[model samples]
Target: MNIDDILAAAESEAPDTRTVKVCVNPAVARKRAALLEALKQAKELDAKASTTEERLGAAPAPTTEHADRAQAELEAFDDEVLKSLITLKFTRLDGERWSNLTAANPMRVDVALDRNYGYNFDAVSKTAAMLTGVRLSDDGEELLTPEQWDRLFKRLSGHDFRLIIDAVWTLNEYAPSQHIEALVKGFGAA
Candidate 1:
């Protein structure tokens, strides 16, 4: 029985209370049935022993192993669903609207991007990239800074150019070249 029903039954049986037959609530009865089934399964797994230590010592059967595997797979499936909901990608980013993302909140922005791509830039690198007009290597293994990094950083901080640049960088990482072109063209129209 659940806590509430157990408490009610004890209260009814107390000398302080007057009661005839104390019936089990339907909801509590249903839950007790489930609990009993689980208890029976546990007992069966323990070579039909009545104690916990015996159950713990028993060798897990093939069916138990399969049940464990299925439970793990089910957990993975649920995690994937949750990740998909939390990391949905946007086809278009409004550069002006999200300019703040390039400044103080770049870390959060990169973290959000990581949820989609399974990777992200550290705060130091992301901030440096925003300040200096640096491009990542085509293979994503290197960073290039042909121009003065500090000057570029100052210029970017003054205006909102990094918003567009960051959007392009994100698109390049996730989309095909042709799609990146289409995105740029679409952004130009706005």
Candidate 2:
């Protein structure tokens, strides 16, 4: 290919992006967790009931009713939780910017190499750089400023906050081969 063709291809490449949904309401989060636990326990009870029926040839009616009730509650609450979630979109930084950012914020860790000296990532700065001024809309019409992002981050639960940061880091740092591996695994390919 000509140099012009190579330059055009490079310039046309779109930035990688990822979106994460975070539950902002503590009450909704608690309710969702409780519903999920109830559903899990109900499923377990149903399985036990099935095993008992195979042995004794009689399954209790109450077990089926309980499981059905728990499932219905969870399904109904799932819709509500979906409506309450705050969606954040992260875009990958350019290679040079990403390298500079990582260099500026390094964390020390134990390595397998000599002297156990390993430098890793600094979570705080890296997350800040990745999540700052994130888009809030698909059309890129709305965005959260750095200050707004910080406030939102602080408001999130520990689990929710970690999920957002992890998604951002993954979008920016995960290799293309890793993405293909994930896609293959998701499709249950050997």
Candidate 3:
């Protein structure tokens, strides 16, 4: 029976005065069961729809741990600076043909470092120098100064291995001489 019929039957039953116990109609019971099943199915479908919508919605941003792990891996990735270092040949900038001299690529390294650890200019600068043997200059231009340039060639010299290799590489690409001079002159002494 339809809902209207069931409701009408229920309304009729409510007004009955001769109630020792009213006999339930089996057909009405069946209709009620069918209605319940339909309601259940509707509820299930609504739940499914809500779940799908949630999945489709913009995901919650990654946790700090997820971000940190990704950043650590990226900073540790050798390819970002390694490939560039391989192609870069020494140019006679200021009449110096140093093999380690190359322009800094700051994008990947900076992103990696900034994402993982809080920015430490000294640490980032040193890391870039170690990894790339060059770094972005202070003005965000090509490497030119003797201080950073020499830092890459000197401290990182003969030592191709370091924990912060990527940072060193970025430093090399940026301001190699300045880094070198800083190390040699001593921090704040220069």
**TM-score per candidate, chains pooled:** 0.21, 0.61, 0.20
**lDDT rank, highest first?**
2, 1, 3
What tens digits encode model 3's per-residue C-alpha lDDT throughout 1-190?
9999998886675221110111123344344455556555655665566566668895443334433444454445434344323111122122121222322322345566544433443444443333333233334425435664454344332233232344333333335566577797886666
Model 1 poorest ten-residue lDDT run: 15-24
Candidate 2 local lDDT, residue 126: 40
Query: Could you give candidate 1's per-residue lDDT for residues 1-190 as a string of tens digits?
Result: 9999998996675221111111113334344455556555554664433345446875544345434444454554554343322111123223442244434443443367545444343343244333332233335423335354344334333123334335445543334456667988999963
- Pull out the clashing pairs in model 1: 131-153
RMSD of each: 27.4, 7.2, 37.6
Model 1 accuracy (lDDT, Cα): 0.40
lDDT of 3: 0.40
Note the Cα lDDT for every prediction shown: 0.40, 0.68, 0.40
User: What does the lDDT read for residue 57 in candidate 1?
Assistant: 77
Query: How many pairs of residues collide in each model?
Result: 1, 0, 42
In model 3, which regions exceed 4 Å deviation?
A: 1-21, 58-190
Q: lDDT score, residue 94, model 3?
A: 26
Global lDDT of model 2 = 0.68
Candidate 3: worst-modelled 10 consecutive residues by lDDT? 15-24
